[model samples]
Target: MESMEPGTVRPGGRTARVRTAVLQAAGDILAERGYSHLDLADIARRAGVGKTTVYRRWGTVTGLVADLLADMAEQSLPRTETGSLLGDLKANARLVQRTLADSRQGPLFKAVIAAATGEARTAEALRHFYDVRVDEWAPCVQQAIDRGEVPEGTDTHEVIRAVSAPLYYRLLAGGGRIDVAAADRAAEAAATAARAGVFLSEGRPR
Candidate 1:
């Protein structure tokens, strides 16, 4: 028998329903309370599933959180192509800003981030989530390079990261507004930097 990893969602039917319910319950708890308050049994009760099922499927809280992060990445919106680098980056930044500013999503992210600080598994999951998102948007920078907007060899991944970093900082550390204006500014700054070769990879002549 193959060993299934915790939080790995099986395809449709009872298993899918169970996974959906359990993950939904977990997200609700994280949003309403926090990671410390997450209990498999409590989630099972909220999800209307058996405690043994939750325990067997997700043996630990970190495992459950990891699965939750995976689910989030899978459900995240696909990138928008607007025929230009700045337009695409602003779209990316605005998406990030809206998520961070969302009433439910904002708090949920804060809880996950705090949990990740002390938990290695959670931190890894968080990194993977961001990686998935970065991969989705990095192509825009490459497209810009093809069009001669940004310099050739501009680190596309870094440019994408720069667009979101200030937005995340506002959510986590800055305690400032994560608004459309801020999103536009982040996008503009990253675009300007990319054009200037600030995100060039090593050995690429500036």
Candidate 2:
């Protein structure tokens, strides 16, 4: 498929096509070349779009990464309501597992992490990605609270963050395999933490 310019609007006025093309190209370059080598001109050339257009739309590398992260947030899997915290967390774990295991996404994330280590804006973009994901999954934790599985005033965002932390640790730290077992472990740990009120009100001690 022919890639369109970053700011090009389609005849039908759909932005999805252009957004997808730009994100896909950005991901490809990040995975193939790493962050230091990521130039807007090179990305535009690879994406078959005008450099001016890419720059006009995403003024800097940081802006492009931020937009890319937003695109990822929009495409993230919807939260699963499975009646229990364990089930919900397991569903979330599986989703993370699948995303990090994908050939392209895995390397792209590694590149992003590597970039974030040295670039403040890239780190901010990475934080934004997690914030969006945390918000998306927070409702599941709230559901558990409503169901009386977790304590009232439990920190839903923290619980959700916990579920994905170990998985990301495995991916980024090379601690262990990112598999179904790891997913299950992550879910179990997060559920246990929630039950123990580890994420409770500030005054509450674990």
For each candidate in the order shown, give its overall lDDT on alpha carbons: 0.88, 0.79
| Pairs that clash in candidate 2 | none
Report how far residue 155 has shifted in candidate 2, in Å.
0.8
Candidate 2 segments exceeding 4 Å error: 1-16
Reference-based lDDT, residue 154, model 2: 95
Model 1 spans with C-alpha error above 4 angstroms: 1-11
Residues 110-196, candidate 1: write the lDDT tens digits. 899999999999999999999998998999999999999989889999999999889888988975899999999999999999999
lDDT by residue for model 2 (1-206), tens: 00112233334243556555666788888877777778888888877777888889899988898788766765566688888999999988888887777676777788888888988988887888788878888998998889899899899999988888898898899988888899889999999999989899787665
Worst window of 10 by summed lDDT in candidate 2: 1-10
Q: Estimate each model's TM-score.
A: 0.93, 0.88
Error of 2 at 65 (Å): 1.2
